[model samples]
Target: MTLAASDRGVVEPSGLMAHYEPRRPVDLGATLGHHRRGAGDPCFAVEGGSFWLTLRTVAGTATLRLSPTPSGVRAEAWGDGAGEALHSVPELLGEGDDWSELDVSAHPLLSDSAHRNPGLRLSRTGRVLDALAPAVIEQRITSVEAFRAWRVLVARHGEEAPGPGPARLRVSPTAAAWKRIPSWEWHRAGVDPGRAATVIRAAGVAAGLERTAVASRGGTDVWRRLRSVVGVGEWTAAETAQRAHGDPDAVSFGDYHLASTVGWALCGEPVDDDALAELLEPWRGQRQRVVRLVLASGFRPPRRGPRMTIQDHRTY
Candidate 1:
């Protein structure tokens, strides 16, 4: 990777002479913007200037190390095959020719937020299966407990990330491994049997579903197909679609928070899915982008009567 142009006496055509940094995939959640408490994966980090970055499942976290290079950047990590995953980040983040031509505007979420990142690329990840599998396990449970349950299960049964650090990142259970989890294990994980069963069933054909999704209508259509699976619903499908393909149109069908977000952003009050769709009609193909921006921009309606009800099937 050589720069065709020169900057501040820096000669052109430098072999990958570019600034690089480690941007956590989970934190890069909102169009590579902010970081959040990763569900159960210890995937977080920041380091010195480096084009190359390394990541690892160290101590129950996705430990990432970014380093700068005279001509470029490099990174590395250890855990649950972190090396292989790191290699794919460039693809997942997407590359840019001119820093300004990223066309992030079309993606309303990334509009003003698109910093003049010198070079950016998306990492190709299949972690969606891992994240969503358990997320569904708690279906209507409290996120507080849900996240805790996820941390426990992932930290326990899942493989440690392949890296040089302590137990940071953990490999999400494989479909086969998920299948082996006993009923009692799920209970301890705070997951109800029904949702757990759904996750197991979905995992059984996850690969097939992913293939069908990309092969069929890309990510959006993939969610539709996934929703067709038994036990899979709109909220689950939307959540899955968002990560499955980094889709920008996946408006969670049952997102309790999103409707209000969109409603508050588009209108001056809270709303429902129908109204949310109507308000988002202008964005059409990019409703999700619009929604993300509204959320990131801090345009949500005031807390309307406490948040949505949190139910737990595990107790049932």
Candidate 2:
């Protein structure tokens, strides 16, 4: 995977180590659980690359180090914002953030989740729009399918991360780059043409969409504005909020499985969206964060129904 970087650099596989503890910035549960979902963790899959990062929740600190090789960015993070800077690359990829100023406890959702994953916290700071385009494309699909398609699409069209190694180092493509993707390529990534069109349309207005998330009022305003795009909806916006804005209230309401997951885990019966929302309401503004805690606590409902089927649009 050829990586693209604003800076020229590289890394030799054997040379890599770093520590991190992003102050009230990282969603640590996402880092440890989401399998490349969180930016704090190194994208160490590329050959000839190594990484190290640590979390210190009580202190609100993170550190970072990036060793650029001929191929990609070899990174190490330690201190208060190390993990933050690394995971925050999406900002550089057309996502933006003013992380220096944020208040964690000011939001009830964050205050509680910080207790849940003390080392990880999401302030009113982050790039909410970066995830919107791809996440909108992921609507109604199984996560396995969504991630697979995302990985494939990104690997194929995105440029490499600028650093060092023979590894595939690519950052997510710019808005212009994504808009230029061919129809056949989207099909190969298991994406339908309809979703592809939505993503392409979104990419064209990517900067404007991102701006909506950080506007003065609240995350809701951003959510409302993004849905103005043809293919975007509550579910898609919810997914984006979880990653982009760190919105605690952005519960994934229309999910086919989440209601069941929450019901079985907490109430032991499959509930509908209303029921799940009722159960989660006490957490209100931080509903998403509470859900994250519930998920992270390692509680899963006992298997009952048929498993979700995986569909590959490429074969058609």
Candidate 3:
């Protein structure tokens, strides 16, 4: 469905409005999953069924408010980049996602999930830098630790979102801004050197990285380019691809808990990466989608031990 742009002098002062009609119901939760950093993410806010996102665009920082309408989703924006943000709203809402060939009829578990969440769509931000920074911070760390680091770093460096929105709505730092972050600040945010260096290197090539969002490049090529960076690897590339391109096949191989979780969900027993890969081989290009289904299947591995201990790198 094509996005319709209109100048509506309604609730928003900017009068900038855009809307899209989806072929199927749009699941706002699944589409906006990548935007929320944590319960306290300063860059994103959701209240009263309206979703707000602050992003840095080529034009400038823009804050977008998305609300559901009877037909589809409506978007309003305020800031210098309002037009750019509105232009990209369709992609962000998964307009380009096509899963028509996926056949889950034979697999009871996946078929059940597909039936349960028919509106689920993989969202694409088309902004690699935004996804990469958080993925880098999450490397080899607990989610709590990574979230804390993200909150601290973004709050310190990100700019306030334009308009009369909540004070907590802020735009993530530009790639240049990220590259300029000092070692001391990284330390303060509890980000280790390796991850910090990776982010910095990525920032240096931010423009090039954005090209990976092009659909024609394919997720494999994007993964290869992302992994060419010093500290980025299979896991980081997959995580980035999933968000930036809505890549269905980008399964995070080296994630600390994913293999076991997927294994148990699919086979009723914890399995290593190899086993998980073998089990998911049938879905090849749709592996990530299968993983998402498993996660949403309400099937979890039996907890036999304590959770991974949270480590505080700030003290180091």
Q: Give lDDT tens digits, candidate 2, residues 176-264.
A: 77899999988987889989998888888877776765433236677777787888878887777665565656788898788998777
Worst 10 residues of 1 by lDDT: 8-17
lDDT of 3 by residue, 1-316 (tens): 2364233211212346767666667788766865688977888888889889988788898999888999888888999988778777766776656678788788888889888877777887878999999999999999999989998999999898998677788888899899999999999999988899999999999899898886532455787889888899889888888888889899899888999998887777888889989999998898888998887777778887678889877788
Clashes of each: 57, 52, 0
Ranking by TM-score: 3, 1, 2
TM-score of each: 0.71, 0.68, 0.93
lDDT of 1 at 171: 51
Record all residue pairs in model 3 with backbone atoms less than 3 Å apart, i.e. clashing.
Answer: none
List the candidate numbers ranked by lDDT, top first: 3, 2, 1
Model 1 regions lying over 4 Å from their true place = 1-40, 43-73, 79-83, 94-124, 212-220, 309-316
User: Whole-model lDDT for model 3 versus the true structure?
Assistant: 0.82
Looking at model 2, report the run of 10 residues with the lowest lDDT sum.
7-16
Question: Please, what is the whole-model Cα lDDT of each candidate in the order they appear?
Answer: 0.53, 0.56, 0.82
> By lDDT, who's the top model here?
3
Residue 115, candidate 1: alpha-carbon lDDT: 42
- lDDT, candidate 2, at 79: 44
